[model samples]
Target: MSEYSQNLRASYEAVWGTYQQFTERNEALLRDILVEGEDYYAIEARTKDLDSFEAKVDLPEKEQKYKDIAEVTDLSGLRIICYLDEDATRVCEQLGELYDIDQEHSVNKNEQLDPDQFGYRSRHFVVAFPADRAALKENARFVGLRAEIQVRTILQHAWAAIDWKLRYKNSAEVPQHLRRRVFRVSALLELADDEFSSLSVSVAHLRDEYERKVDAGDLSIAIDRESIDIFIEKDVDLEALVALAEDIGYSIAPNHPNARDPYGGVISTASLAGMSTIDEVRTKIAEVVAKKEPRLRQVFEAWREPDRPPRLVVSKAGLARLAIVLSVEVPQAVALVEKLPFGPKLQSALLDVLRNG
Candidate 1:
């Protein structure tokens, strides 16, 4: 080993601990930031290993221009893998806000590709603790050290991995005949990424529109995951049934294990019952509230005991589903009881009330 190489290795080794700590701290911060917003795929970090560091320094003498190890901005690396392109962009913006970005070295790989070319697409940020943070006693050690943050959608990350395996950094590097085919594959992935982003935005807009319509009493907006949620939140009949059940000591546990898909379960039950619009759901629930209200209490009492609580706990959404099932005729209601999300004991208690009524 050359004296210069040994010295460079030692320099990296001396700060490797601090770099490791930096990645851990920053990774945690990134997780907290991302958690406050939409869901993300993953956040990962690593300190460049000794061999990888050596490989960079051992590049041909002409290419080995780093006289100081600090020039290597990626000695510590972090990756934020998101589900959508807009999420990746949002992460990049958050990174910029949280750290001092070295704008000169940082690059958006998406922009680097011309319209006609595509291979790798990610947002790379060379970042370090900002002046204010670095001035803090605990952050002083991370003052001068920088880390590379790579933000990419899962699709882009997959493409990058496949591109790495193919050993082609870009379309320009491939043989002329093969370049066209590679570009085609790359174009397809880019299109899929854009489509996914578009679908995500559309879903968000639709959810907003559904909530607005449901809040405005527009039950004609068809039943769906979003509408079902807003409908349950605002539905008076559903609330009334839940109040009746609660009056009988039946608890509404929104976070229970069985409550995971209360909204989705209603969608399924509503489908089987042939209720397509929120208005239909409301009317059916109101029917149960008016006529079958006593039967609903009977089902609740069947599950309760003299000195004990009810064996099965149902959520408000569950109450809506129960009402919908009981609204149908006895034979159909009995058949649909199995479709509702309940354990055997509770379903049996519910079935008894439906059939014996």
Candidate 2:
């Protein structure tokens, strides 16, 4: 290797090392904001030699201009891919706050672009180390070096990887006919992105509606598949009565202590089945309270200062009946019933279930 090549390689290594450090620091910050259920992944820093320094000696005019140039980044690039578009934006925003961004550009595939240009689209940001961060490192050599950060959704990354592989294999020289074919492929990828975005929106809407119906005491509503299995395993099938209440817009809060208590599991089917209006739901719940008052007194007398409140327990048969009513009358009622309180709300939920049935 030439003396200049060795120097450039060393410079690239230093720059690449700095880039890794910066990304590791920022990635830790990103982990804090990631949602509990979502998947987030990071890519390793990629380094490539620009080979620009070699031109300085051969070309006299370029030699004068680049004489002072220490190093140009070898393809030392880093890409951060996020699962969701929102996540991409959030990561980008956090990066902006943490780094000194030079030039930020975004390309939405939905938008129009020149047909002739190579269009593997993504959001690119040219970033430099922050001035404050510069003090942390003694070496001033990498102070002005800029690294390119590309942000893309998973789908965009899929297209980019394929496009990149093709370019590498063919040396980026495409016949005119193949060029048009590539453009068409790009258009198809754009359409796929739009379709995915639309499907995501629709799924969100369905979830919201499910929650609404459950809260309104619509006992006929179907329960979420996973939730149903959980409830059945726990023998808390009566919880479906809460969904019935939710379908009718009755807000039922869970009693955490009672949720685990086998005896306190008594949920009132009468209150839920009887509630036609919001007022009636409340009145029916009051009746359950009136009944539970004497039972609590008896239980307190028997065991003074019990660790937990006595749950208005119902039988397994009653829960099965409630489930049947909810499933038959309001398919979404089971979702609401699952969220109801063990005592009053449970009773009301049961009544709603029976009435709906």
Candidate 3:
């Protein structure tokens, strides 16, 4: 609100649209970089409002004051809040490859902390897309403008959001007595953030190990949801299933959970037909899937409804169980329609699908 900054408001407002466009383009570029492999909790872009920018320019000490409002680095801001603190650094590394990082203006907030301190750990960067990136269709305009990018862990983001909502302009505004308590809360958040990152790394390591075992044809690993995913991704004869599904006028979504969890839902259903090993389950499902045409002829022989085509297209789990049922006792499946064991609605639906054959 100083007269000095008051004179600069119009100058800030003049290029506002260009900066908005710049931030949006910057966000898109960041998204493409992340899509290459990195995933984050959130990514967003915003124009630093006239009010916040004004405060920054006016509030700094006279010796540090900006001679021009355009000197402010965060006139446009983009934030990439990630699940792990390490990912924030990874994001920064990737960003450096795509843009010209204004090293003097940016700071590694995490690196600034003292040995025992736990506080705001955000990475801020001032950057402009390099000429090659600037030449892209979407980024062609607003190529020269720079924006500030902030990367933080979710916990750090949580602390930042709460701190901002409290409207404390700076550390000095918090009561001297409550400052220690605030620091303690930050320490706890820091601990949780580190633990989350460690957990993520550990799980990824375990998955990689399990995938190796699956690749070697190891069936010793217990059939479970996660294990099944690895098996389907690496082990299963998916082409056979796809061909069978198509032959029966059924479309198979290869990515369906049951298809992935062959060792899980599918295997459990196969167990009723005496399938225990992964190989056995795979063979039976393939056989049952292949028998669909013949089985349909048996079930639909008495019922005639050409107009209402039977919804034989079921999820992999249902298909697995239906195969077991048809392979074992076709009469037992018909018997369940009247008894309605799985519940009236589900049993009725089962009858409708099977009767279509």
Choose the strongest candidate by lDDT: 1
lDDT of 1: 0.81
Q: What is the C-alpha RMSD of each candidate to the true structure, in Å?
A: 2.9, 11.6, 5.3
> In model 3, where is the ten-residue run with the lowest total lDDT?
296-305
Instruction: Give the candidates in order of lDDT, highest first.
Output: 1, 3, 2
Among these predictions, the greatest TM-score belongs to 1
**Clash count for each candidate, listed in order shown:** 0, 60, 1
Off by over 4 Å in 2: 1-7, 13-23, 26-42, 47-76, 104-112, 117-119, 129-146, 168-173, 176-181, 222-357
lDDT by residue for model 1 over 1-357, one digit each (tens)?
A: 556666788888888888889888888878887862364688879999887887778767724477788898998899988888888877787787899999999999878987655768998999998998789898888888889999998889998899888888756678988988898888899899999989988888998998887778778978887788778778888888777777766788774643445587778888889888989999998887776478877887777667755445877777888888878888777767775656666687788887777
19-125: candidate 2 lDDT, tens digit per residue: 55555554443455544224345543554434443433335443333333333322335677766676667777877786787642323442433445444666776
Q: What lDDT tens digits, residue by residue, belong to model 3 across residues 90-188? A: 887888898899999999888897644446679899988888878888777666678899988889898888767765434566788887787778779
Residue 208, candidate 1: how far off, in angstroms?
Answer: 3.9
Comparison by TM-score, 1 against 3, better one: 1
TM-score, prediction 1: 0.88
* Model 1 ranges off by over 4 Å: 1-3, 36-39, 61-64, 175-177, 255-262, 304-312, 339-341
